[model samples]
Target: MRAVRSIKGRLGTAAALAVPLAAFATEASAHVKWFCAYDVAGQPRGLAEVLCADFEWLTGLALACLMLGCLAEGTPLGIALLNALDRVTTRIRTDTHLLVRVTLGFFFVSLWSLGGIILTPELTTDAAWIPWLQLGLAGLLISPRTTPLVGFGIVFLFAYATAQYGAFHLADYPVFLGVAAYLILTGLGISVLGLRPIDVVRWTAAITLMWASVEKWAYPHWTDPLIAAKPAMTMGASPELFMKAAGVIEFTLAFALIWTPLVRRTSAIILAGIFVSAVFEFGKVDAIGHSGIIVVLLAIAADDVRAAASRRQVVLAPAYYGAALAGFLALYYVGHALLFGGPAELTGMPVI
Candidate 1:
């Protein structure tokens, strides 16, 4: 009775602690979600180059193609494509997972639509679900199986369309092959690696940190625009340090999540904040803001994203991964010293 009572009290205490933290995470993750669209020129892209670079434009072009396909294919063809997609997705038989995924994707897109129109500077008032309604129209083409092909075909067409753009470089055609290659590899990686939630959290955190770190490291001026754009960034005590420290913190936390269980719990809590910031920071722009919303939706569904492990696993895994992390960092320290001159995990080990 004493031990049981002790356990209950501890549980109650832990729950109490978690409440404020959870609220902080949610509020931090929350962006000024727009409920309508604006017609402002040049306001489409955010301050981040990721919001303006190939990734952003390509996504926009792809979505535009999805729009075109819906227009070209019409309602019947869309339904037929969906039915065909259902058949294809069933082959792998991850329908339950895929259903959850697509629904989240839909929900996030809708949220983005709401945010896009509400925050945008140009559109009158009716464009609330603009991109999302387009997404909905295209959603008809979104059967698990067919959605892949549809998404692929649309992206491909966009790339092809863009070959005629920008200096009219006939040479640019080969460049697209690399992009195509990346998409193929990405699709495969997601299916193969994302089978486990632990893998998802670890890799996503690592990737996010790496990407964030590289932008600042490569260009000293990189964060100036970011700080300028996010009013909240200014509020952070030492925004510059906050930016740099956030990168290192994420990198370390990602390592902890993968290798240390106790740290995983702590790191997961922090990462929840990191991801929300990433989403809000990204989502404020034209293209990626919506993408951020989509990712957030995915995060919500993948219960194991920051999920708790079994008690037994928790007891054993943290120490194992922690020890592993020490060795890995040591190895990194040496390799960086010998070859790269010094450890740039802080600034030099740039994002791939």
Candidate 2:
């Protein structure tokens, strides 16, 4: 009886650990391929179709849940969690050295050269000058004095690449580009408009995740092919259900970033782990695509923004922020559905 009880306890502990391990492992894994439509041959079929009718009701229910969760934030448990989070954030270290910046620059340049990082990697026009341009930018980023120029150049290149690919088709990756640009800008400079660059990187990174999360909710079917290919992603749950849960997890983490510095760092760490895991599945493109986000997460981890003891300012109260986020998501998803028919209608159809 004693041996049996010990075995049972061991099993229970394994089960508990497995749940979070699975969740973290799957974070952001079903990306790139999902946001846009694709054929069975793995060919791009253009923008993903948004099935409004299928998910509209679900979205509403999720919003209601969010509202309830937000209300709960005012309770003692929430306050305690927030206070604990503040303590963690206050202890983070934000000071970065020149070597880190130079290393990051070298890494990005190498990725660009390898054709890992770019908008619509498979679809870009074959141009000889692009590599040279990337190398030039990388060189510029090595110096503190030239970092801002390289930053602006990167912003332009990313924008140009997106425009070349047709902006509407690529969808949310541009948000990642914006984060990269900001990181470059701030890493080279002390501050932007009196705000620490790391702070801006934290906020922007959070926003990028939040924005990408909506696509999962709005177009779950976009990920159907991926789920079909990798059944393990479902982890025994229905594909639809898993997609919805994934979106909620991503959005909740992103929302947590705004709540406290501790939460921000925690979210960044989790997100970085997810991105790292994705590289194993998606290869070089995943690494290239997520490099900027990973860098931002690292910066957030290094940031040491402490809360003022005298006056703690809540940037946006949880309740109001949650409500506003819900409203914005509804508008964006519904509007997208109206403009472009849902996945069922657009499957195999080219956006252009």
Per-prediction count of colliding residue pairs? 16, 3
Tell me the tens digit of each residue's lDDT in model 1 across 44-137. Answer: 1112432234433433342342233324222443334333433443433343335434543554455445544321222223434445543553
CA error at residue 308 for candidate 2, angstroms: 4.6
Which 10-residue window of candidate 1 scores lowest in summed lDDT?
A: 37-46
* Global lDDT scores for all candidate models: 0.37, 0.57
State the TM-score for model 1: 0.39
lDDT per residue for candidate 2 within 120-232, as digits (tens), equals 34545567677667778777766667766766776776777666754544455545455555656665665667766556666666666777677666556677767777787
Best model number under TM-score: 2
Q: What is the lDDT of residue 33 in candidate 1?
A: 19
TM-score, candidate 2, is 0.68
